[model samples]
Target: MIPLLVCDDSAMARKQLIRALPAEWPVSITQATQGEEALAAIRQGLGRVVLLDLTMPVMDGYQVLAQLRAEGLSCKVVVVSGDVQEEAMRRVQELGALGFIKKPAPAEEVRATLQRLGLLDLEPPLAPTAPRPELALKVNFRDALREVSNVAMGRAAALLAQVLGTFVRLPIPQVNIFEVSELHMALLDAQRGQRLSAVCQGFIGDAIAGEALLLFHDLEIGAIANLLGWQPQNETETSEMLLDLASILTGACLSGIAEQIDVRFSQGHPQLLGQHSAIEQLIRLNRERWKNTLAVEISYSLEGHAVHFDLLLLFTEDSLSRLTKKIYYLMEQE
Candidate 1:
């Protein structure tokens, strides 16, 4: 195995780097506390690549690098430093460093780069991505994930109906994959009384569960009332009904997802996003982190009724791939 050395003054930084490396990297790694130790290690001809930090005690990275280069050291050097100044990076390149990794580099990105450079062996072949079908369906990768969501959601609804002692109707989940810029347009559509009242619970598993929004749009709520043989006198009464509806819906959705993922999730209580301009209000409430919405909205319809609802499952773009892999993995398991 090719040996790599990590040279940094701080243990915490080293730990973070180690944690980010892919589990399957083939290289055996060693650590050096400072530039002097790193130089000593290099003299011993131990490692092929030396990951050098910029700042160090006794001997800084620049001095160590200059000395090593002057002496014609052949080990590949990758500068790993928090300093992102253009000059620093240029200088590292001038000193014969093979690569530069910004401090706090995302783990997956780093692993991929290393693997491409032949520093690490290849990982197992991932399951094939879903192919374009003969029918030429107008769907993206998001749609495939939505199908996974649908199976999980159906199971969730059944679980909720069992808990609530009421016949809960779930609509087929509709997924929309739009950029952050499209969120404003989606809100405009959702605001024109198109928003559903939903109760939501948060569940955790592999990554910490972010908040979950369980909701039904206007049509689903009306249909549910009709299915249950209740005539809600006003919108307020209809909204109140959705409190229980949202709870049941959330239960079903989480249950389905958890079952597919083969893991349990910690859940939180559902809440109301009911208002005259409910969509706008809900978006504003989560404005800080949800500044840009890459949302997955699911709608449930009451069985044998016209009442249908909308549930918005929002996540950032970064998490979308993890979500996809999880769904795909689950599908393969089945």
Candidate 2:
């Protein structure tokens, strides 16, 4: 049985990867929290495969790759980063990695990769984690972050319904916390073009609120304009209006959530963009630092006709602190 090494700074990511692996593979798996720990693991034994994430606090994956190459270590490496840029991909290939797995790679795909590498004989069906017990969540901080999205998203939808003058129905948005690379890829689907436009604003309340985002397609701009009762025009003017519309929606949506969650946050004006390669670029421009991340996907109809596709909110870690306080306050009141 080939030995397998899983290295990532995030505990959540590590658990997800473990669950995705073939259950019957006789391979003994080892863990590393960061690049230094990975080096220590290598000293312990020569593993056949090392699944690594790119970003970390003490040392990054790229640096680890450089050190390993310099020392002439030759373990088969599989990158499991959220970043899938052309340059990033090229760099990893240059660093002697065997392959890449986009974050949240389907369980089947993870199994297939191991088989192709001759690491596994058979694959097992992927099973989701069971819901945690209520008492467990009450004491756990991470679970509270997940629930924040559920409560906030519900309030945001109600606000959307009122603003659009129509009933807006939406499922409770699922929260998937990830590194910037993974978060960026999920938010910016490849099917969409390279050129992207967005509206961004900040919110401040009991806890810090990073801002909400409304990302959209240029071609779909006309559809949105029609829904809003505006005539479409040339590209320049149309682009401006789209940004404004996004700003209004994002502001109202986030504010509504804040009020319901028992937090008061002040929001800034929306910024317009003609081209943004990564959403993190926008975050950098805004000078926002977040401790946590919460993403809420929103889909609602405009006037019972055209449906607008927008992400309601993406909260940062610090902003998430506010959510935690609010939840406990509400729970105490209950």
> Please, what is the whole-model Cα lDDT of each candidate in the order they appear?
0.61, 0.61
Against the correct fold, how does model 2 do in TM-score? 0.49
Question: At residue 246, what lDDT does model 2 achieve?
Answer: 71
lDDT of 1 at 305: 52
lDDT of 1 by residue, 202-308 (tens): 55666635456654555555556765567889867776677666666666666666665565777776667565455566556656655554566755444345554
Model 2 per-residue lDDT tens digits across residues 1-334: 5667888765545655766776555555787878988977876774567998765557778878888898887688888764444445667889987677765446788888877766564234334434312112122335343334434444445455544545454433445565555566666662155455666666667656666767665556666676567775676777677766676567656655565466667877766655555365754564335324665555443435544555646667666556667756643432
| TM-score for all models, in order of appearance | 0.46, 0.49
Clashing pairs for model 2 are 82-182, 204-265, 204-266, 205-264, 208-319, 291-317, 291-318, 292-317
Q: Report residue 23 deviation for candidate 1 (angstroms).
A: 34
Model 2, total clashes: 8
lDDT of 2 at 78: 85
Residue-pair clashes, model 1: 18
